[model samples]
Target: MKIKDIVNRDVVNLENCEDEAIHIPGLIQPHGFLISIDADKEIINVCSENISQFLDYRYNEILGKRIDDILGKDFKETLREFKSNSLEKKTVFLTYNDQSYALTIHKSQENIIFEAEPNKVPLNEEGNLFESSKRLLSSIEDTNSLKELSQSVATAIKNITGYDRVMIYKFDHEYNGEVYAEVREEHLEPFLGLHYPHTDIPPQARALYIKNLLRIIGNIDYVPAKLYTYVESKVDTLDLSLSVLRSVSPIHVEYLKNMGVGATLTVSLIHKGKLWGLVACHHYSTKFLSQETRNAVKLYGYFITSQIDVRILNEQYEVAKKANEYVDKLSSKSLEFKRDSLTSLFQDDAIYQLCNGSGFSACIDGKVYSNGETPTEEDIRLISEVLFDIQSDGKVITSTFPRQNKGLGSVAEKFPGINFHMLDDTNYLMWFREPTIKNIKWAGDPSKAIEKDKKGLSPRKSFETFTENVKDTSKPWLQPEIDACNKFKFFFQSFLRAILTNEDKEKQRILTENLKAVNSELENIGWISAHDLQEPLRKIRMMASTMLEDQQRFQVTEVAEKRISRMSKSAERMQTLIKDILEYNRASSEEDNFEKVDLNDLLQEIKKELKETLEEEKAELVIEGYLPEVSGLQFLIKQCLLNPIHNAIKFKHPDRRLRIRIFDDQNHSKSDMYSVISIQDNGIGFDNQHNEKIFKIFSRLHSKSDYEGTGIGLAFCKKIMLKHRGFIDAQGQPNEGATIRLYFPKVS
Candidate 1:
């Protein structure tokens, strides 16, 4: 047939090769013959065209024959016995025309397939298969590293199969193949350390390798024998996934031929039910292994696969042991320092080495802290925004090629790799890796891995070494390293939660104390309503009754007028008490309305509201140094300053004029973090021992007749300061002056 005709007939082009139905190719290699029979009727349904070469019958004669009539009742009984059990495949040797053949039987969808090949090796070799596997496993178990294990496997397989060359090919995360270890003849060129693009083995091919543990091509140049179905049968295509003699893809055959390989064998190394790598053998000339030898090799591959997980975990344990030490150190340091642990941890070089990172950055409580090498603050912010948008449920995110992500491409040259974890909405941690230039050696130019020619699509023909330089990528993060990062995240989050819990406990304690104080104040209020408030009401009623009776007897007199004047004063005092109580209630229940509040502006407003009172008291209010801006409720802050200023005028010393000064506190050192403003008054002051008690609700040091006040003003100011997450302090000296200071936390 013409090459073009053959290409069109069977070759799957690269464009659609991923969807190729290689499992049901309906052809078998010429070295072996295949026959399939219906499971229910035991009648032949499909048979390879080359079956006549072994069965002493033409294709037509064997097409519709019963299993018992074609291969005798003994073979039928064997098939029944094999079917009764749960084995995947069963092999039995039978003598036909003075030649012994090994027939492998397996079940397809609803049919049973039998593949037969000539038995060239002695039965004695099959008896020693267990011993051979034992020695191979021993050699593999003694290896200390993955590379050593792979090299040992390659050498063992090469010595057993007598192939010209043997290689252990491992796949990367992208499914690209790398010749990890190799054993070759003395004169042959080396293929070790060469990389192959993922396109070399399409997804479909890799899937087949996972299903079938072992596959061999006896001769790559041999013709394929087409499968012939019975005239009365409905089966058009036969599934040969388990067929030992299944024909290889035309593309795969061409690939082998291009490399001058006449025969090849591949044994899958499966770990954790997934294909980890492969043991690939190549022969310079047409070669074939007996069924016994192939079975021995398959058993050896199984033992090697069993050891993979154990060895890998053993290696990772060492790394994890060291990582645990770093975690312990970090925990100790975080506990030892009461400040920001994220900042303190980064200050030590050990944190950078913990993850083998070139740079580190952390966002703790909306503050950014970084160490080692890092991008600009603006760039870090941009990256953080992208990360937060994609973050979900605090899962750790990692990438080797950060440039592939949107908005990060520009900064990827400096920060090529990143490992990130979010603690909360506003807090996160990140580790960065700098780009390290890498020189890679490929089996061929990967850029030309696939090409379209007259044959539709073909793999590259050259096997010469090709060099390429890779950039903008750091060394890929190993699984152990990533696990360590996860451990660190857990530890750090626990530390943060502990800190928050302690703060919460302290706040709760304060709240409990305030609740008790409030209960005491409510009791005092009840007493005032019963005695202090009712006293005025009693006097007004008594005075009115006396006037009414006296008016009935005679005209109004001076004594009656005196009683009326006292009633008027009593009514005024009752009205003031009710208003103060209402104001105190509003202060307790009002929600915070926080914004930038200029203290200077607030004091000016207070001055205007109390203008009449200041004038009546002849109070000299002086403004000292400028007051700074703070975050607080404007209206509430105005009230906070108004009450103190009003008190200075109300309680002035009878011997002298009252003087009040408002200014920012110059004594506090942490001005950057807090805004402390003080109000000092030169008026009648109480003993210093009553500094805290004066702010208590209804706590009066002097008689009510002397001060004419309800004592609720200072308490209201204290509540406002508490709502702003700040505090108010009072200091006083009898017959001297009093100073009250408000400490407000500066907004970030």
Candidate 2:
């Protein structure tokens, strides 16, 4: 159905669904018996209809009885000694009537669940878990691609476990899963590429999958064993999330029965500590895996996950390499039109590769550049107003018009594909995406999962090929498109800064004038609209916070938690951007109250502003010796100092204490008309070749994982220097440190 319906209902709606929860089923799989004991170490709960067969005690007598009363004194002491090791899965077995019984004890939500299964089959003492693991590992050792790896994984698991069918199910961003790979008997109908809605595996079930990591059901049609407990047991329901023989949800069992599946086994494929996907095994008839074989499959899952990670990294590297090559080509073509840097800072082709569009537009300094089938200048200004209204985490906004998504409305429809990359806050890189109508294939009807029935609203379970011809929508911007924007934006901005940050005074003066001229329009409009736009973003952040705090009350489970966390992070980023925009506007203002500024006083003010951050990072800021007074804008000087110093702390080396040493020997000036101040930090250093480019606006070398920032700090420092009629420069060696030297002219 519709995404909005699913978004609001997926977690909150608790209609009778077999997948939602099974822990409190009040029943157990007939294959085993379940008993829960609280802190008092007495039998507080039971679910076995045949407790006598396993424990040789009456079900009613077991309630409120200690283990000694049920299994005798020596066995209770043996259980205590077994539990003292604090192992993940503790076990002890006893032959109660010439029959071997296997007992497993594991703690769940502070309550210990005692599960005992009859060792129905004769033990094969010769079976080797390690040998089974090695065979499984060797089966897929040479797989190099995801497709090959997935195929190998499915085939190997099927062969090792002897299941009738094995499926490699992978999850998407929205939790919807696709059967990526499958291996089954040749006569069976293929479900190779079928997709399953997220409703099929509700929040509680997915959470259980994450907790247990492996699960098995011996038979779908077996009757559930009823649990009996004292009326004063205090626990109305047992948290069977970690139980190996937890009763399968009745609805889930029915769903499986409908599909003609008899038994099942599944293992989680985890990547970077998150549930990535699963290896779901199905049988046409009743089946069971030996404990040793189960352990072997688990170990095999670990290697498969690692291989998946490796293949993903390789694919990403390939994509990035290709994008870099494309950027280099775009840069080469752009040089032809940038004949004169002063007349046209952007020849309209500068951002074309960065934004794959039929038309391109750029608003920077006070200048506007446009080419191809772009919106009218007035329309561009109007669209830019809308662009300035919304703030995003990545400083980029994209929309597919057919969905009637937010940002630039009819303007996006006119072009079909629209992307606005905020250079800072006001200035942007805009592209008009040409429309191309095409048909999309979905594995299911894609209707809302919830439907009203005779029993009221419930999840719909119809999956069929639904085709819809999407119109007025350009090709969607994939992750690669996003990477393209981020990568080339870095390149283009660095190119601009390299041209501007020159030592030659005449060239610098010419370029600085052009920079201000091209970007002045954005600065003017941005200041007035900023305050009004900020409140909505704050409201959005507040909503996210409220939802997260009340998550449990509203039944916002793991699924909604992830989405809300992302929303919170994005909103926080937006707020930071808005504030940065405000600071930047004020920092760039020409109204100069240039005065004798004491360097020591400014540093102290900044230190006060960053006190909490300094304490958190455990960083030390050292000012060496006496500081010289310079004639400069106090606010402008603060902007210069604030950004660099903050960055020094932000990118501190995790392994060592951060040290930022400010050295001002005042040795570089020959005529006393200029004095130099160097801010040095022993943090992640960059290559010397990129030192000049790093000062450019939005120039960043490391990704957010290595370090996170909008890449506007040093750019502001450069501008603040240019405002003071002084100079700022930097020198760095990779992994050593970086020194940003600010040359304040008229020091005397």
Candidate 3:
């Protein structure tokens, strides 16, 4: 088949695809049984056709019967207790008619579902829980790398459960998974190192992984119990997301049968609120585990997920340590080269290591410099123009030549890959990748159309390797490479300008004058209002307050006391307005105070000042990037950061706690020769039409009662940006949140 056909067929229209309802599956796995009860404590619904195996009553006789009549009053009361507290799941150890059984109960909608499997296995473990947990931790810690860790986890799980096969599956960017590590029985044909298409587990199924901790399928060949109800009630459909014995989709069951797997167990690996991957264990014949063992496996997975950060940090520290030393060496060497900053970087080959791309190109002061294989000069100009338009705050912009994205792909397909970190509009450090072919082996021919019926789309019947030769793509850029590009941007921007300036005193003097801080007319007006008007406002407030005290003591009329109170409050408002203006003026001083302002230290101080406000609002503050010291007036920088964060806490969304994330800008890298900081919050945002008006002095989008402010906070932020010879911009949506980005020049 043609390449176009292969690519087109592989794409799944997830948005438009019809989803099968799993909750109303009308069946349950035969190994276990399901009993759904209504709000009145009546077992109005019974799913299993044969219920005598585990319980004493018949499934046919359960409809319209009270749950207490079958499961006893204690079980009924327990269900009511969990529901009253709005809990989702409850597990109880009980004896029904003198026979012991473990019942897993949960309330869904107005009804309750009780999934019961005869608790056949004993609570006694095959091994000591404390010792097993300790050993698992030791084995994982012994691994030196991520790959080793993956293999070790598979082995540890296999040793714990003795499953026929165990595999550590990792999800890629697109949700497709590969068996990164595997341990299987000697007699089993290895499915090791095999890739699985996302169609094998649809997007909906993937989302369910996060809701439930573990899923088990016992005896794929066993008959499924059917659900039935005698009441004529129009009971709404149930949500089976947390059902332990929820019946599997027929298509998924068929896919497992094709692989000759009798039963399977899956537990999710969640990290940073996203599904990282899964630990899948398959048994060749019908297999069951005690509840204690299931809990152990869950604890093991949770432990591994918790350790992911430590593992990543250990790797990053090594890379960042080397990058740091290399950058320092380059900065010192650039001063000695006695050439343009970009020229020094190219001559020493420092830019190549930033991304490890096939080639390096630069547009320094409107002149192009390049090394290694690259597109034609005209093509380079065209690609650069497109990237420059979409550039973000102050970091490297990266993109692959996608064949599907209509907006980016149109310009991107002309080259293999592009990653550029711009210092300004005319100066940039660009990396390019030479075109290469990707030889990928799919489990089944993804190009073939999936089977569909009245039920829904089913998984492919075959699981054979099918190779596809993908063309015109370069080696994918990893996250670390992108991070390195971001770091490179700051180093080059700062050192390049410094070296060029220090080369000649005359040029340096001229550049200084051009960027010299100048107070704007707005600052002068604000300063006058703050310095000249505050004394009278304070006096007015004090006099009014004193009059109100005297009126109350002298038994004055109610109207007179109320009038005095209003006057005092108005004076208080004026006093607050004057105070805000004074702070704005303080931030507007046009002093060229060039010193290293360690942003992390500054941020800590800011957080401490806002601690009370943040605590009241239940705010969560997050810092995502490495904040470096920049050359600026320290006090003004502090003011710039403080106001926006304070605003975020003040205007937080009522439905959710305030989440404010501050990170260095990665988009606008141009000759302004500065770094931008972005403060984004999830709050009640205003329309972007008022974005500019928000920075105006005395501008108020909200009344004082709704959000108390003098409206000079952003004005103060804008002035600080002006004094630093930089810029600030605001973007927001009604009720969504806002981002306030302040750019500060890195004057070396």
Give candidate 3 misplaced runs (Cα > 4 Å).
1-18, 40-47, 122-131, 334-341, 389-399, 402-415, 435-438, 452-457, 499-748
Per-residue lDDT of 41-113 in model 2, one digit per residue for the tens? 5555544566776766757766776766666675687667656876556666666677666677787665677
In candidate 2, how many Å is residue 550 off? 99
Listed per candidate, the RMSD to the true structure in angstroms reads 17.9, 29.5, 27.7
lDDT of 1 by residue, 135-184 (tens): 66788768877778788877777767889999988888788899999999
Model 2 regions lying over 4 Å from their true place: 1-21, 43-47, 72-78, 87-102, 120-132, 329-361, 365-384, 397-420, 430-444, 448-452, 455-484, 498-748
Error of 1 at 697 (Å): 12
lDDT of 3: 0.74
TM-score (all chains, Cα) for each model: 0.70, 0.59, 0.62
Scored against the true structure, residue 404 in model 1 reaches a CA lDDT of 59
* Residue-level lDDT tens digits of model 3 in 1-748: 1010001121123222336555456667777777778766565554466577777767766766777777778887887787788777878777777766668887777778888777666544655666677787888878766667777777777877778999888788778888878899998777776778766677778888888878988787877776665544444345678888777777678788877889999989898888888999999899887776787888877766787777777766666666556555665662542455456567555555555667778776677877766667776787777667767763444445555334655446655677777777677878887656767777777754257655556667777787778665777665666777777667667766666667677677877766543345657667776767777877887877777678757666889778878887887887877777677666645558678889998998888887887787789888887886777788878878888888988898999888999988766564356677889998998899999999998899999888888889898888878877788999998889999988777646
The 10-residue segment of model 3 with minimum total lDDT is 1-10
